[model samples]
Target: MIDMTTGNPGKLITRFALPLLLGNILQQTYNIVDSIVVGNFIGSEALAAVGNSGIIIFLLISMFAGIGMGAVILVSQFFGAKQEEKLRTAVDTIYIGMSVAALIITLCGIGAAEPFLRLMHTPEGATMEMSVTYVRTIFLGTAMSFGYNINASILQGIGDSKSPLLFLSIATVLNIVLDLLFVTVFDMGVFGVALATIIAQGTSFIFGAVYINRKIKIFRLFSHRMRFDSRILLQSFQIGLPAGIQNLLFCVGTIVLQRLVNSYGPAFMAGYSATNKIDMFVFMPILSFANAITTYVGQNVGAKNLDRVKEGVRSALIISVSTAIIMSILVTIFGRYLLMAFTQDAEVIKTGEEFIKRLMPGYFLLAIIFTLNSTVRGAGETFMPMLASFVSLLVARVPLAYLFNYIGGRYNIFWCYGAGWFAGSLIIVSYYLSGRWKNKAFRFVEEAEKPKR
Candidate 1:
């Protein structure tokens, strides 16, 4: 594990972010492969179904993942502060809590799968059935999904980003192999795709658990009894709850947007889905930098080197924005070709190309917002970031989407994404400029330095 408390900010952030970027790209392949397989084999309707189900799965998973972010922040801070016991407790608490949450979510997701899809106004008949089948199968493996995410978060918190990349590489390759085998050979359609994802995710989680237990000396997962510290749990919730609520709200907004996509028919939906896979690739670098900054700021905050935190954010902004600009250009040039890889349908390809054109310009704005928010969150000031997201997604994007739809129909709805990013960047920039987050970081560091009972 690398320590960020002392290093050249640019190199450290880049070193940490590169592996994460590659891992996120690989992770996106799960969806890309699923889309390609289903769109080519089972047809556009099935592709739409998979895309619709993906949003709901994200909605469910993102809430808990936000809470998981709390554990990650605490882990980074504790490790930086050299509070070894606290770090171990934080890790154990998240594992136990997330495991239980995964079980509960799985049950609720399976029971409510059809109802949720129907509520989203998923197309009637085969689309609805396929969405329900795919979603429920995915939910059944929630434990595996949560398990892997928790492992990755903890490792990231401790400045070990590369290990998660290796884990994801295994899962991604396995997912592709299974996707082709089940969907192509077995002809299992949507069910085959979902099953492949679950099996691959489960393998990765099991492998991560074993690797961590055997190789990692700083903490033990299975070798010792796991402890539940209420203090750490409460602290994690305090830091994570607002972010969780923000994610929940964001997902709710996306569900509204998904309903808009649904009204456009299966072809548009398939196009939108394909674009989303490509979108993940474009945004992965931004996300990687954001995550890296979070850990960088967290470590510096814990070390009481507030200047380094600022320096890291600056370095991150330069790298991430430059990367985003290049990505926008590349996507503009090659997006059509990428869409062609998914399906031969001209309408679907047209719709996806339009999506790339409308949204590519806004990625730099998104990069700025994510970088600033992650910086604040790393310093244990999560509420502001949450508030910023709420304003951007719910207050701005969701409303503008409907308004644009009312004005110019489906074609204009994507404009709201840029508007939302602009709105969020304003909030985060203002907050960062105010410098209140530094006080928050100092308070957290003081707390960390206190003697444990």
Candidate 2:
């Protein structure tokens, strides 16, 4: 619908990527703002309660959010093909699947909250209690969060990335104000952090849902079409499930790393947690650009403009790699100041600064893997991503982390993140270059000249 196949890609990419980058950054403001309000208001240990659960939070919501990837793929293809009926089908179908997923995850959240906190070996005292309270509150809001992701993905697929950016900006700013008042004014502690995130996420979902209902002329909620279509569900799952599982595996691996971090005590835990927020700021833009390439590639490929897809990818690579190099330099230089922003602990700041120095070199490789995997997803190939993650997380990272703790020495643990990132990048890029996700990967390509329906 946006005619991505014929646009000047440099102009198109900058226009699309800039708003997306802003959206992603503002979306992260929920966390950065939470850390600032809490650490400054409460103290370092309480900050650790809110901070340390980062991976666990991803684990709870990621599966359903992955359906959003499927939504983007499905809707973008239909949009490029100008199939209005199918685009509407994608929106309705995604809500059904994601709602079911949200319910299941919520149940898991209710049951698993205490056990997970215990598993983290949280210290006996107020801090452990705070961790449990924070995690449960965040988990209860999974539906609203995933609902927003699914709807936003569908809209973005149809070329409306800016709308999500606009609404998220309002939500995140509200979240910041709430975090300050709840933690500083009312003394809510870690629960305030969770409450703020949920409120922000819920507000964003409501705004997006309402805006699309009245404004997006391409989509209309049809009551008669409320029932599930087995065919559509199956196709969506084919694209989304693997991506979801990749995220699941990645989260699992991080939880393992969190355990490793915990073994070093709360100071290390707080430091690692605080530094990671800084890391994500750099990661988000590259991620947003990767998403842009996915949409650009998806639209052109859907229209059967293979050359445009290829050229778009080429331009994207140059831009992405260049941006990653810039982040590497900035992170290396600003690493200490970032940690000091959250905690004034001399030891924690030192640990975090050292970690950042070790970590920046891997950002380029991480960017490469991100761009390539997103490209595969755009082309509707999710299996390689799933397999790549399985190997990277389960087979490589977790085991390597164990070995690092056991033999590579205690301080070498953070290096596991870098090593795992590099290995995953190699695995992802190798898979892409191996011609597996290429349309030619299917032997049926010669027999059937068009994408299989």
Candidate 3:
């Protein structure tokens, strides 16, 4: 049996995080490949066009993924508690994913794709039409992204992280192959790049849906209704709503920051984008452990094994701290080479180097922050991470960026983002230490489910 409900904490965390790390690495292979193709083939401007859309990109994907997190939290708990019926009931959660918000965001995102690029002051020489192609293409594929996230989340919720990773690996390879073929053979540029990603993700969506249908033995899901169930919908929304909102708010804040990066022109845009890539490298392993903790914490909490949750958190802390230190050193030392991987432009390289040095120190704090938040959330403590991000992102980061950009030069923009990460980390640290989330329970989901009269 694939038991996520009980296990040794240290062994559990390692087992879970390793596959998660591999999954993340595979996922990133798409981006790294895209960057090299876009940078070398179309030029830095094309890279910036893609880079400039980071907010819209993150907003769309993260929003649904956030909802996925909700399912993970609830289903993990149910599975841990050995409540098979509740687990089956939760299958309806997919409806929360197919929302009006998805439509609204996609339309607005596609519509604003070009204008937003212009707002960033995209250099005419580099970004002409490329931004539009990149943003519009990504927005068009939101439905595929939605499906993939839902299917994958369902698998992850039951502690089958490797299952999602398996299909995702296939998709990642297809994406790269298509990216090279389109960009190289067809001479398609950004549009080719964008199309490749959508097709790849769409392919993954198909594979995941088919795989789950054949493998996961949920009755209502596989037999009863090919339609959305109110009970399942309610549970899905109950879990996904807050996470969705949090990611939306966070993405909005990133848009504010993206606008600031825009003002620096394409060279700076490329530099800062490279820095963002570096940040992801830092985020992956910590994220790996954090993701594990959610399952570890969620299942254990459901099984009423609070002791295991505590122990897993400790193991996560040691792993996270060590990884953070190592990544910071690697980033600090190889920052230039990494930047060079994206663009050979001397000006962009210099700017990327400068931006990275400023952000390196904060990686350690972020390592703790991400792990703690994920652990808490996995333990069913959503509010703290939500509250922490809300305050730090909207209240601190946005306003601070405005202030710094107005008074200081471009360097202040980088600092503004760093400061928000720093502040959010502190808030998360305080919240984790408080032990309040430990007392809270995920009652929203259970109450949301009702029988048809």
Candidate 4:
């Protein structure tokens, strides 16, 4: 784990963010590959089916994904304060709790799959059937998904991004091979897409487990010394619940928007899905810096180096905003090619081109939201950042999407994204400048001076 509290802010961020950026890129690429194989080999209807279930899966996953973010906050602080024992405890507790939680969530997800799709007014006939099948299959692998994310979060919490990067790299390549094998060779259809992802995620979890056993002496599974600790679990959820709620609410807003998108039919759904895959890559590099800042700020906050934390935030903004601007231009230029990479259908490509044009230009605006929110979340001041998501989704994005859909029709639905980004960024930036997060950040190190259990 790297000590981020002592380095030059720019260099520290760069060093920390590159691995995360590449890992995120690879993750998104594999996701894109799934769409490519599904869209090309299976058909646009299958692509829409996958897209139709995307928000539901995310909504379910967000229930515990936020806990991983919380783990990072606590783990980074413990590492920063040199509380090795507490750090290990936090890691072990998070893993155990998430494993159990994953099982519950999986059961809930599979049970709720059809109802959730029905509520979303998922397209009828093949689209609805495929969506249900894909989600149920993916839900079955929820434990593996949770395992990989929790372990990776533990790695990131201690400022070791490279281990997760290595594991993800292996999974990405394996996922592609499996995608082709299942979808093209075996003709398994949408179920193939879900199965490939599960296999890759399960493999990555195994790799992470092996690496931890070998390298992290403190993280052995089921060691008599490594029993569960309720306090650490509470601490993790305390910080993580807001993040989980934010993602849940954020997905809630997307589900709302998605229902509207569904109104436009399967063609638009396939188009939007294709563009969404490309969009993940677009924001990923900038968001990686945001994630890096979270670790940097978490360590600094724990060390009580508030000034250094401030400097790190500023440095991250500079790098992230610059990168966003560059990416915006590139996406505008090559948006068509990116869309074409997913599907060859003329209508899908044209619809995606329009969405990309409206959306990519505002990514620079969204960069501020990501960076500021990450900084605050790292400091354990997640409520306000969580509030920003509510504003972005409910107060701004969803309403705008519906209004546009009612008045201007299909294309104007894209404008809501830019509007939401601008509004959310403004709210988060105002909070950052108000300097309230400094007040909210708990002295985690001081509080946990005496390790529990």
Which candidate ranks first by lDDT, i.e. highest? 1
Compared with the true structure, all predictions reach lDDT values of 0.90, 0.77, 0.77, 0.88
lDDT of 3 by residue, 1-453 (tens): 257556678887888788778988888878888988998888888888777776767766676667667766887888877777777666664544465456866787788777766665666755757877788988888877776766776776777888889888988999999999999999999989889988998899888877887777753343455455565555555556667778989988877777777777888888887777777877899888888888888888777777777888899999888998899889989999989989899988988898888778777777777888887887656777887788778987788888987888777656665677778888888877888877665454344344467
List ranges where model 2 is wrong by over 4 Å. Answer: 221-227, 440-453
- State the displacement of the C-alpha of residue 152, model 3, in Å, after optimal TM-score superposition: 1.9
- Prediction 4 TM-score vs. true: 0.98
Summarize candidate 4's per-residue lDDT along 1-453 as a digit string, tens digits.
Answer: 788989698898889999999999999988888899998998999999998898999999895889778877998998888788888788778877888889988999999999999888888899999999999999999988888887787888788999999899888999999999998999999999999999999999999888888998745755677657687777778889999999999889998888888887888889999988888888898889988999999888888889999988889999889998998899899989888887888888888998998898788888899999999999988898899988988999999998987898888899999999888888899999999888867556677886545
- Candidate 2 per-residue lDDT, tens place, 1-453, comes to 255767787667667788889999998777788888777788878877887766677887777667668667877776766666666767788777778888898889867877887787776676687888888898899887886776667767887788888788878898988898888888888888788888888888888878887888877543565655556677667778888888898888778778777777777878888888998998997898888888886776667676676677778778888898898898899888878889898877877887787778877877887788888888888888787667767777788878987986656666666677677777788887776676632221121233436
My TM-score estimates for the predictions, one after another, are 0.98, 0.93, 0.91, 0.98
Model 3 residue pairs with clashes? none
Tens digits of per-residue lDDT for model 1, 123-237: 9999999999999999999999988888898999999999999899999999999999998899998999999999999999999999998878888885467888887787778
Angstrom error at residue 18, model 1: 0.5
* Candidate 1 Cα RMSD after full superposition onto the native fold (Å): 1.2
Which stretches in model 4 have alpha-carbon errors above 4 Å? 450-453
| Greater-lDDT candidate between 3 and 4 | 4
Question: Cα deviation of 412 in candidate 1 (Å)?
Answer: 1.1
